[model samples]
Target: MQPDVPTASCCGEADAYFADEIHVRDGKTYAIITDDRPDEPRGRPHVDIGTEIEVPDHKLKWDKGNPTGHGIIFLSRNRYVFCYVQPGGA
Candidate 1:
């Protein structure tokens, strides 16, 4: 069975993107993976594997992974987090 893919109310917004579908497994939700953004800076630093990244905890569904105590884990640059109020989104 497929996970419930929520609709992103923020569409056509500037400097932002949204996922069309997502998958939930082991109580953790994940979206389709991506690498880098079109507007990404040329020399922007890349986040390494296992490094803790900040994510909206309120939108997170689980708690057991990182410093935030929110189970939202960003294990790769391709891991796009699914949050309730996306940054720069409407």
Candidate 2:
């Protein structure tokens, strides 16, 4: 997590949100799009690789090997949800 990442919320939440738009660059999960809002500048919109993410119901190992980007929403460390966003749209 860089110092200039934007913060986001799902619909309406109080906790801080951390997002990383990763792509397979030389077989590495590189942070191409980040949102650290209120602390860092928002990055430009870009298309991510991956299929639609289903809302997670339990804690699972986040596989970064996938070339597609996945969006996840979690309630603390227990309840978790996953989804996918099209680059720049909320």
Candidate 3:
């Protein structure tokens, strides 16, 4: 499924973290990657859109403790994975 958001990136915070698109959206999935920079901005963080996240079913780490069950995993280091389950990561 295509992303509802029009644009797909907002990581232009002047020499900010290095964000790269490992895989472009193939009509379903794309990856917005970033490095583990020590100077990552905590406030007013950069945003990325028009990106696709591929969360393999096996990649998920279920707590198996919570009633609703949660997945605590990330596909990148740029902190781009700060939201809920990525596009095609189910």
The whole-model lDDT of each prediction reads: 0.33, 0.30, 0.34
- Residues 13-81 of candidate 1 have per-residue lDDT tens digits of 232233323456666544432323443453323443333334434444332222322122222235344
lDDT by residue (1-90, candidate 2, tens digit) is 111122433322332133444344444332332433442232222223332223322222242212323332222323233222222322
Clashing pairs in 3: 8-49, 8-50, 9-49, 30-52, 55-89
Worst 10 residues of 3 by lDDT: 63-72
Best by lDDT: 3
- Indicate the residue-level lDDT of 63 in model 1: 22
Q: Answer with 1 or 2, whichever has the higher TM-score.
A: 1
Against the true structure, what is each candidate's TM-score?
0.28, 0.24, 0.25
Error of 1 at 55 (Å): 7.7
lDDT (tens digit, per residue) of candidate 3 on 9-67: 32233323332444435444334534344435533344454334563333322222222
- Candidate that beats the other on lDDT, 2 or 3, i.e. the better one: 3
Which 10 successive residues of model 2 have the least lDDT summed? 1-10
Q: What would the TM-score be for candidate 2 when compared with the true structure? A: 0.24
Provide backbone clash counts, one per model: 0, 11, 5
